[model samples]
Target: MARAPTTADAFNAVAEPRRRDILNYLALAERSVSEIVDALEMEQPSVSKHLRVLKDVGLVDARREGRQMLYRVNALAIRPLWEWTTTFERLWRHQLVKVKENAEKKTNL
Candidate 1:
């Protein structure tokens, strides 16, 4: 049997839609806080707040670039989510196959 996937604080960070959107945006490339705020057309405080949560969960990494800090996706942090979700996908597919077979049998009867 496969071992359980590692669960990180990332789950909580992704609970909010805004945070998830931030992750998607970051996937393209690292950006400074100001850059994110500008692209999102949201207040600086709001952007910073989301970034704080993401930073706490290890889904993103930040470093000082000049006077500003830039953030980027930390792929390793979400590995567990990917593993568990893929497993769920497989389980759902199997269930659907069985349901279809049962329906076909009933129709044939």
Candidate 2:
């Protein structure tokens, strides 16, 4: 049996440039696995592997439509990423303020 991918695993998987491209495409609309493969010009198996991870992490949803399995972004999973990132936004702003102050001091010297 395979262990299910966690949220960290899902985010890490998409840290790959190509995998991020896949998510960007899915962001526009739901797609069949074939559509993703053709759009990315990548191997079907590789695309499938990424999709499996996405699904496991609740970042993507999959459903069988007749002979095809369709996939779409999971809004819930992406929501947490937004919530998590917002915390860092405040921290970065504070750091930037300090950096700007240091830069001004150096320029005066």
Candidate 3:
């Protein structure tokens, strides 16, 4: 099957690692492109490209602040991603329980 374009949806857009990093950074607070580049240790152009993809998918919001454009995560747009992942929460909890049980057993041995 052909791969969907990055702009197809939030999932496709965030599939890229750099875009995920951008989202994580923006989650803390809105920031300028230069700040993202500096904090993430990525080139300005690369950060810009990832930001564009995120914006296209509605996962990010950008606005001008004086001479700089600030970017932030759109929590509403990310809701679907969060909801989808949460469907697997039970599985994750089960795995964690198994790990804890194994560790306790080892300690008791």
RMSD of each: 6.2, 3.5, 2.0
Better of 1 and 3 by lDDT: 3
* Candidate 2 vs. true structure, TM-score: 0.74
Which one wins by TM-score: 1 or 2? 1
Q: Model 3: per-residue lDDT, tens digit, 25-94?
A: 9999999999999999999999999899999989989999999999999989989989999999999999
Which candidate number maximizes lDDT?
A: 3
- The worst-scoring run of ten residues by lDDT in candidate 2 lies at 1-10
Higher-ranked by TM-score: 1 or 3: 3
Compared with the true structure, the alpha-carbon lDDT of candidate 2 equals 0.82
Q: Which of 2 and 3 is ahead in lDDT?
A: 3
Model 3 TM-score (2 dp) = 0.82
Order the candidates by lDDT, highest first.
Answer: 3, 1, 2
lDDT of each: 0.86, 0.82, 0.93
lDDT of 2 by residue, 1-109 (tens): 6654334555665566876777889999999999999998999999998888787777789999998899998777777667879989989999999999999999999
lDDT of 1 by residue, 32-107 (tens): 9998898888889999889888888788899998999999999898898898799789789999999999999999
- Could you say which candidate leads in TM-score? 3
Kindly give the stretch of ten consecutive residues in candidate 1 with the minimal lDDT sum: 1-10
Between candidates 2 and 3, the one scoring higher on TM-score is 3
